[model samples]
Target: MRYARFTGLISVLVANAIPGTALGQSVRIVPDLTTNSIVVFQGVDETAHFYYVPLEMDFVRAADGKPRLGVQYFKEGDGDSWRVAVSTSIKPAASDSELAALKAKLPKDNNVTLSPLVLDFASSYVRFSEAKKPTIFSLESGTLSAGSSIAMKFEFTGTHDAVLQALAASGPEVGVMAIITPDASLVQGEELVFSGAAVADLFEKEKFLLLNSFDESNAVVAFIINGNHSAEAAARSWLKSKLGSPEIGKDDKGVWRYGWDLTRPELLADLRSSPKISLPTFSNVEPPNKALLLPFGNICKDYPDNIVNLETGTAGCN
Candidate 1:
């Protein structure tokens, strides 16, 4: 019973994401109190980076409900590896007397040692039961049928052996998600109520959509950062060293400006060629500070299939 309770907790906080809502284009942005409006720095060539900063007082639980302090990062581009993150508790010694006690106050676990970000992963067996190759097909945009739903026919692409095995297996299963930004005329916070063992979960639902059972999280927040070339890469190389979240440099503080070229053809061409946008880095950036972290929750409950925030704009696109 304890184990079952633990697993239930694990399911909530692990931070799982289905590609449907978005990894690159459509993700959530929760600003901190220090923030007002976010400057999107729009252009094309430079790279995009994201950071997941956690507060020591705030505890992010696992899907099974284990308490932890962690976040994720997403590099915007076509890369497979990025960074996972962890933050160590800090101790201060402003005075000689306090310095004397520093050693004792410091966390004993070497796991708290300051270092570059590390790889944090979500398990497959817990979320996915077996293997089945993904088959691709184009839909007619008309009456969707059962064995005829548009989801069952997409070619799953990847060289991983485990992924390869899953594609060929029969029975109920899930795969990459397909998310559509509905026309803005619809009200905010109304999602389709749907579910399935596989893509079929969403095959014929004519309502706002919900996160699939296979998906671990109903909402996702991704931060993708990248550099175009060596010069920009050089200025921003430190950014990579500090992917998850950087301490505000206790001694010398600075915004530390660094950006990558956004126009490098060779770097993005590979990504542009594919219909799918691949996000390499996903970090648990700012927490869901009541206002930001969950602004969309109530609305999300209303517009389960929606990807747009209504308050930010005047609706008339229809």
Candidate 2:
């Protein structure tokens, strides 16, 4: 009865259904190479709206060629608070002794270590109006063996408002699912690989100071700016002078984020002309472009005076 604590309020019955199969929802698995994780998002019928579940898994191969799965779960707390409820690793047990050792290292009453873990949605789905009582959702992790599959069953209840609010508060989880193999077929969306040499060339030609760059995927790249306040100000001003005012916001950790998605045809054309950097060409899909500015150690609301809009170059406080 781990999930029984919040069951006294309402009784609604809802079953976790797969997206796009009679149900009006669809699931998308997006791979993020920057963090080495895959993100599963549940969307509603080809719309731009989607919400990721709180469950995330990271899979990596050990030196012994065995697959190691890292699982993390986030639970909603009181008044815009969220905390990690479970953070554990799972791997195949080769022998009885190994299994015993693994169990000894795990939490005393952790249901995740148990075979065929049943993830009852008593608390998670209670807030959803469409959810039903006594839901029988289960996440079956049969065996951690390679080539074996794990099945997850859970419904996204509520009007997506709750889900969106929770995500906006807690931030999106960045990890992959254990069920998908590393060599799985590429999902929808064209993959674009950034050329490190080309990026270096842009810096060499004084396009912009390439402090550091991370190729998030074949399609996206994130650049880290200088950490100092003065340097950050200068970089922000330069970006604004070049790219126009960027979309500014703060992450869950309160760190300021300046983002730009250059998927627009005009923006792409502008970038190609000015930066002169090599852009990926596709026969069917348009190339993806994104730029993110992260000033290390600078938290939001702390440096209001230093904040300036990139577009107007006005020294304004955020």
Candidate 3:
């Protein structure tokens, strides 16, 4: 793995268990459009579920194991089954003993063998498989270029088509961060402060200044997405009156920022208010909040001034 070689994947977590506990069995992570934290669940449903914690990134250990990310391995109320999200430093057990311990604690109902799964602890880019499908997790070696179109999950499809179509039809928004590679390719773009259909579209960091999604609350979009160069160009053409040709300049510090005095105020306002989008929730997973699907994360591991909250767990089989 690279220094910060991290990626995303929907995975199974590990924890201990007790007999006769009817707490939960499966994990359900709902990126609440209403806030920055995710509503974590296990058990048959949400009501019996417990622990709504922060979905951290990269480090398996999040600053004293501050509830990193992972799906619960055993049912709810089971000993430590929900405490998962591997740390880089804490090595996993030598296999057999760990899995055996897990299998023993789980209910006779659909007991499973624990599998080591990779994760993009930062971005929630995952498609869970009901049939226990195997997955491959890889990382991009370099950052994308400026002006290059970046797509989320180049291997996945239909990330946020409807919203991308809207953005493609509408001009770009302010306070939004569009990712670009060194070569000026529009690798990806994001509306850091917006939600709903708008968030369904943004997938990368902002090259320009960032806008707060909310006061002290960074409730970002729930899904990863890519910019459609063709669609964006076509949309800009359609909304010429609202869009303007502005100068892209850098400050003394060499940070890239867009000069937007000529941009449409209405468009800017719309983009500014588009944060906090609700993703479609799964009734089968957790029924209480059907309108609770969205993405929440930051591209911090590789960031220069960033801090890493490393964590580790010592789980053993009974």
Q: Which candidate's lDDT is highest?
A: 2
State how far residue 59 of model 3 sits from its true place (Å): 3.3
Q: What is the TM-score of each predicted model, taking all chains together?
A: 0.12, 0.15, 0.17
Tens-digit lDDT track of model 3 for 9-81: 1222222322343322344332331123222323323223222222222222355543222211112253322
Model 1 misplaced regions, further than 4 Å: 1-151, 156-174, 180-184, 187-318
> How many steric clashes between backbone atoms does each model show?
67, 8, 47
lDDT, residue 164, candidate 1: 22
lDDT score of residue 143 within candidate 2: 26
User: Over the full model, what C-alpha lDDT does candidate 1 score relative to the true structure?
Assistant: 0.22
Q: Where's the lowest-lDDT run of ten residues in candidate 3?
A: 1-10
